[model samples]
Target: MTERRQSVQQSPADWVARQAELYEESGGTEGTTMRGAPCLLMDYRGRRTGDWRRTVLIFGRDGEDYLVVASNGGADNHPLWYLNLESDPRVRLRVLTERFDARAETLGHEEKQRVWPHLVEVFPPYADYQRGTSRDIPVVRLRRV
Candidate 1:
């Protein structure tokens, strides 16, 4: 049987869609940064639709692992991508010119506390995002699978 590839559904947000377009079109060369922060293109399977979805997320380094925040700009609800990954942790990440399969792990309280500072340092606005919402923002660790 031939393996079929599903076309990814881009974010509805115009900026996000455009950024993903530039990033992929340039082979991870362009659109690699978001407001001075490094970014990566993450592909995940939708929970309900089962279709591929793509989004651009700011990433931080935790040794060899890549970290992403589910701040959702301090909204009360988590981002759709985060929710999708919660149901299915399998993902594909494109960092710069490299692409690989990864598994998303949502850090628990203690673990997030340990690395929270480092994540804030990566993108200082994260601190503000946390304070702006009552929800405890989740920090997800992406490790190569």
Candidate 2:
């Protein structure tokens, strides 16, 4: 399996670049909404290709860190961003007025159980997103590196 897969045909359009632009122009102040829910643009390099890719993901803050889930809206497959992170665990993130280096890791089961509620709180759709699919949604915490 590749560290990053080809962009899916149904993937959101220009979401990466647009989010970057919005975030940059806002001096990190704005451009945080994705489909009406709060999101942050995650940037990482493909482990196989070594090219940069970005995805917009629902996010919640934890102290000085950020949390993202590979919900894929409860789809059977993990989201492309999940694959990208699998490819290269090191990543960069942009959230309202701040840019930071981050390390991504899957949460343990108990940790996930604890954090899942936190994710849903940031974006209530996560609970609904969980119910719509059979795959186990993964919660990844991005800690500053």
Model 2 lDDT at residue 105: 90
Q: In candidate 1, what are the lDDT values of residues 68-126, reduced to their tens digit?
A: 99999989899999999999999998999998889999999999999999888889999
Clashing pairs in 1: none
Model 2: per-residue Cα lDDT over 51-122, one tens digit each:
677777778877777889898877889987788788778887777777777899988899889878788878
Clashing pairs in 2: 28-97
Q: Which prediction has the highest lDDT against the true structure?
A: 1
Deviation from native of the Cα of residue 132 in model 2, angstroms:
1.4
Query: Once model 1 is optimally superposed onto the true structure by TM-score, how far is the C-alpha of residue 112 displaced, in angstroms?
Result: 0.4
Worst 10 residues of 1 by lDDT: 1-10
